[model samples]
Every structure is written in C-alpha cells, then in structure tokens.
Target: MAHRKWIVWIRRAILLVLLGALVYHSTIVIQIIRFRTINPRMTALMRQRAREARARGQVPKRLQVWLPYERFSPHLVRAVLAGEDPRFFVHHGFDWDQIREAIQENLEEGEIVRGASTITQQLAKNLFLSTSRNPVRKLHEAVITVELEMLLGKRRILELYLNVIEWGDGIYGAEAAARHYFGRSAAQLTPEQAAFLAAIIPNPRETYNPARHPARVERRRRIIQRRMRHVLIPAPFRAASAKAAESAFAP
Candidate 1:
C-alpha cells in the first residue's frame, strides 16, 4: 500500500512540475505576442545587467533611444547585415548552413571559433533570455526564436534588434550608439563609420571597442565594407539600402 502511494505521489509531483513549466512558457509566449505591437521598455539583457550592477553596488545606467526603421542609416543596415548575418533575409529563424559551417570550423579548431546564431535568435535571446549558452537555455531560445519569427516578421525583428542590441557599457540601440560615439544620429552615419560600428558589435563595450582598439576595428571595418558591397538587403530595407548593398539574394 505504501509503495503504491509513493508511486502516486511521484506522478503527481511530476504532473505539477510539468504544469508549472507549461505556465512559464505560456507566459513567455504571451509577452512575445505583445511585442508584435508594443516595443519593450527593457529587455532581458537590460534587466539582467541592471541586477548585476545592483549586486556590484553601482547604479544601473541605460542609454537607448528607439529609432524608426526609416530613421536608421542604409549604410548601417547593410553594414550590420554584412558583419552579422549575410543570409538574414533567406533564413527563417535559424541558418542551417552557417550552423553546419560553425560546427565544422569548431571541430577543426578544437574550440568554439564561430557562432551560428541568426539575427532572429540573437534578438530572441536579448529580449527574453539570459546570457548563458547552456543546452536548456538554448532550447528555450530556439522556441522563442520560432515564436518571434512567426509573430513579428522579418522587418519588425530587424527593427527591434537594432533598437535593443548592446553597443557599449550603458549604450543601447543605433541612435544611442551614434549619439554617444560620434555625436551624430543613427541616420547620419557614413559607410565607413557604419561598418566600423558593426565591426565592434561582438564586444563593443570592451574587446572590440573602437576607442580602445582602433587598429582591430579598422581591419574588421574594411572586411565588413567588402561584404556590404556583395550582400543584398531584404525587401523592407531595400528602399533604404545602400547602393553597394545590391547583390544576389540567393543563399
């Protein structure tokens, strides 16, 4: 009798845990749906950074000014696409070719040398998840990525990504980064400047900072400029895309 009762309790506990997980994931889905219209005031990354700052006995500072899609410079858009995801327009939420390439590269290098996270995946992580790359978090990120792609569409995803990407210690968004770094608006950035900005995105706050590593940034900027000339911007950004951005869209 006691063994049967123990088994029943175990099943109930498992059911409760599953129910809780469903509720948690459902809440995230609702938030993602809301994001289709309402821009988030703060993202998961922003909130996490704030918490970290508080833990370190410092005030959390944020600098972000949302710019409409049209307000973003064509050079900036092209540069970002070139630097981050050339196949942004072709892929849904994940770039399988890049994933395979990255896996192969990592295997050859015997280390993680490249990442395959698409713009959609990156945006999903920024908006909803932690900085951790653990398998569980990655699974959740994948789910959220699909939800974002299904709900927000490509143009909206790109807009949100540009508006929320971390550029520096306290900086967020192209508008804020432009103002902080160059004393200009996002729409005013030149091609070279835009490429440089995109080049530093991987670790803009530290490692790849233009202020701290001008030579490295210049090298990356040059590479991105070359790529920008060979990549095509998607339909939503086509009207605003740079002349150099015209290229075959097939991936």
Candidate 2:
C-alpha cells in the first residue's frame, strides 16, 4: 500500500509539473499572437501623440510611434531594402547564405562584427527584447522570430519593421526620422535623405547626428546617391525624391 501511494504521488507531481509548463507556454503563445496581430494603426497613433508630447517637454505617454508604410516614401523603403537586406523579399525569416557568410566572418575575426539576422529577426528583437546580450535572450529572439514569421506574412513584417525601427535617441519610424533628420515628412524623403537614414540603422545612436556629424552624413549621403542613381521610379516621384535629398545634410 505504501509503495503504491508513493508511485501515485510521484505520477501526480509529474503531471502537475507538465501542466504548469503547458500553461506557461500557452500564455507566451497568446502574448506573441496578440503582439503580432494587434491593430498597427492604433499603435502608430498612440506613438505619434507620445512623440508630440515628448517634443513639447510634456510627459511622454508612450515609448515610441510607428508610422504606417504608406506615410513613408518609396525611396525610403528602397534605401532600407538595399542597405539592410537586398534579398528581403526572397527569404522566409532566415537567410542561409548570409548566415553562413556571417559565421565565416565571425570565425575569421574571432568577434561578432556581423549579424545575419533577417528583417524578421530584427522585428522580433525590436518588438520583444531589451538590450540584453545573452544566450537565453538570443534563444528567445530566435523562437519569437519564427513565431512572428508564422503569424505575419512578409509584407506585414516589413510594415512592422518600417514603423518600429529606431531612428534616433527618441525617434521611431521613417516619418519621425525624416522630420527629425531632414525637417520633412516621410513621404517627402528623397533617395539621398532616405539613404542617410538607412546608413544609420547599423548604429543609430552614434551615426545619425546632422549638426555634429556633417562630414559623416555627407559621405553616407553621397554613397547612397551613387548606389541608387541607376534605380528607377516614376518620373514625378523621382523628382520629388531628389528634391528632398538635394539639401538633406545642408546646414
């Protein structure tokens, strides 16, 4: 009788532990789904209001504003695409070639100078993580990246990235970045201005100061212009894009 009771207790304990784990996993899944599918417009509006409040030296109501893709210029999108991931449209959530190359580079340098994270991976990190660099955080980032890719399509993922990308210390999204960097709307960003913003994505905190880093900005702008000159868009749109970028880093 004693042996049977002990066995029963052990089984019950095992079952309880399994149930607890199931519940925890279910909660995390629910949160991920909600985060991925929540109305983006509402989030954008809230962020915009918060940005305004912060600019006015009032209490910030939110962390960041995320502008929808429509509010951004095609040049902005193209510049980001060219600079970050030229094969963005072709990959699912991970790019094997880039991953392999980054691995090789890391091994050769004995450092982590290159990361092969796709746009989806970047979104997963931006939306869900703090600035902790740990194995646990990296594992979670990968899991969440897969989950988000499963939940959101490529277009939706890109949309989220465009809106959520941190442009400056407090600036978020292309619209805010364009206004803060160039004194214009996102839709008005030209290829050069867009390229300047794109160049800063690698290290936004250190790379994107217009007044203080005029030389660096000019160099990046020239590079972006040179790279994008051959790319084609509509004539009128191209003219407007060129206009916005013409005096992008001008004092």
Candidate 3:
C-alpha cells in the first residue's frame, strides 16, 4: 500500500511540474503576440542593468527613442546586418550551419568558445530571459526564439532588435546610439559612422567610446563596410521613405 501511495505521489508531482511548464510557456506566447504591435518599454537586460545601478546607488538614465523601421538610415541597418548576422534573413530562428561550425570548433579547441546565436535568439534572450550562460537559459532562449519568429515574422523581429539592442551604458536603440556616438540622428548616420557603431555592439558597455579603442574599432568597421557592399537589404527591412533622404545626401 505504501509503495502504491509513493508512486501515486510521484506521478502527481510530475503532472504538477508539467502543468507549470505549460502555463509558463503559454504566458510567453501571449507576451510575444502582444509585442507584435506594441513596443516594449524595457527589456530583461535593461531591467537587469537598472537593478545593478540601483544597487550601486547610481541613477540609470535610459536613453531610448523609438524610431519606426523607415526612419532609420539604411546604412545603419546594412552595417548591423553585416557585422552581426550576415544570414539574418536566410535562416529561420536558428542558424544550423553556424551551429555545426561552432560545435566542431569547440570540440577541436576542447572548450566552448564560439557563439552561433542568430539575431532572433539574441532578441529573445534580451526581451524575456536573463543574461545567464547556462544550459537551462539557452534552452529557454531557443523556445522563446521560436515563439518570436512564429508570431512577429522577420520584419518585426529585426525592427524590435534594432530598437532594443544596447549600444552603451543606458544607451538603447539606433537613434540613441547614433546621437550619443556621433551627435546625429539614426536617419543621418553615414556609412563609416554606422560601421563604427556596429563594431562596438559586441562589447557595447566596455567600448562605448570608440575613440578609446580606435585601432580595434576601425579594423572591425572596415570589415563590416566590406561585408555591407555584398549584403542586400531585403524588401521587408528596406526603408521606403528613406530614398529621398539618401539621394539628397548622396556622396
């Protein structure tokens, strides 16, 4: 009788856990749907940084001004795509080729080093998940990535990503980044200036001031510029309203 009771309790516990997971995932799906049209006020990373600043008794001044996809310069978009994910429009939520390459490299090096996260995965992590680099966090990130891609589509995904990605301490979005870095608007970002911004994305917080690391930033900027030449911005992400602006400022 005791053995049967123990088995019954174990089953009940498993069912409860499964139910919790279902509810949690359902919530995430709902949030993704809502975010399709509504811009998020703050993301997980933004909130985390705010908490850290509060703990240190420093006031966090988040500088983010939402600009529609068409208002941003095409140069900035191309530069970011070139530097971060050259295959952003080609893959689903995950880049299988990059993952395979990363796995092979890690095995050969005997350590996990290379990252194969697509822009979708990064957006999912930034929006809903913490910055923890554990297996569980990665699993959550993957699940969230699927939800985002399914609900938001590529255009919305890229729009949200460009608007939320951090460019410096408390500086968020392309507009804020452009102004802070070059005293210009996102729509006015030149190719070289945009490339510099793209280059600092990997180490945004530490290398916010490109002048501090001119050689490294310049080298990465040149690489992005070269890649941008070959990259074609898809119709979905192309700014319909920026043609006149581009022509007016054409060099």
Candidate 3 residue pairs that clash? none
lDDT: the better of candidates 1 and 2:
1
Decreasing TM-score order of the candidates: 1, 3, 2
Instruction: Identify the leading candidate in terms of lDDT.
Output: 1
Candidate 2: which stretches are off by over 4 Å?
1-25, 35-65, 100-115, 207-251
Could you give me the TM-score of model 1 versus the true structure? 0.86
- Alpha-carbon lDDT, every model: 0.83, 0.66, 0.82
> In lDDT terms, how accurate is model 3?
0.82
Off by over 4 Å in 3: 1-13, 100-115, 207-212, 241-251
TM-scores for all candidates? 0.86, 0.65, 0.85
Query: TM-score of predicted model 3?
Result: 0.85
Candidate 3, 133-192: lDDT as tens digits: 999889889899988888987888989988998888899999999999889899888888
Q: What are the per-residue Cα lDDT tens digits for candidate 1 across 55-145?
A: 9999998999999887788888888887777788888898999888768865885534345788899998899899897998998899888
Better model by TM-score: candidate 1 vs candidate 3: 1
Candidate 2 residue 78 Cα shift, in angstroms, is 1.0
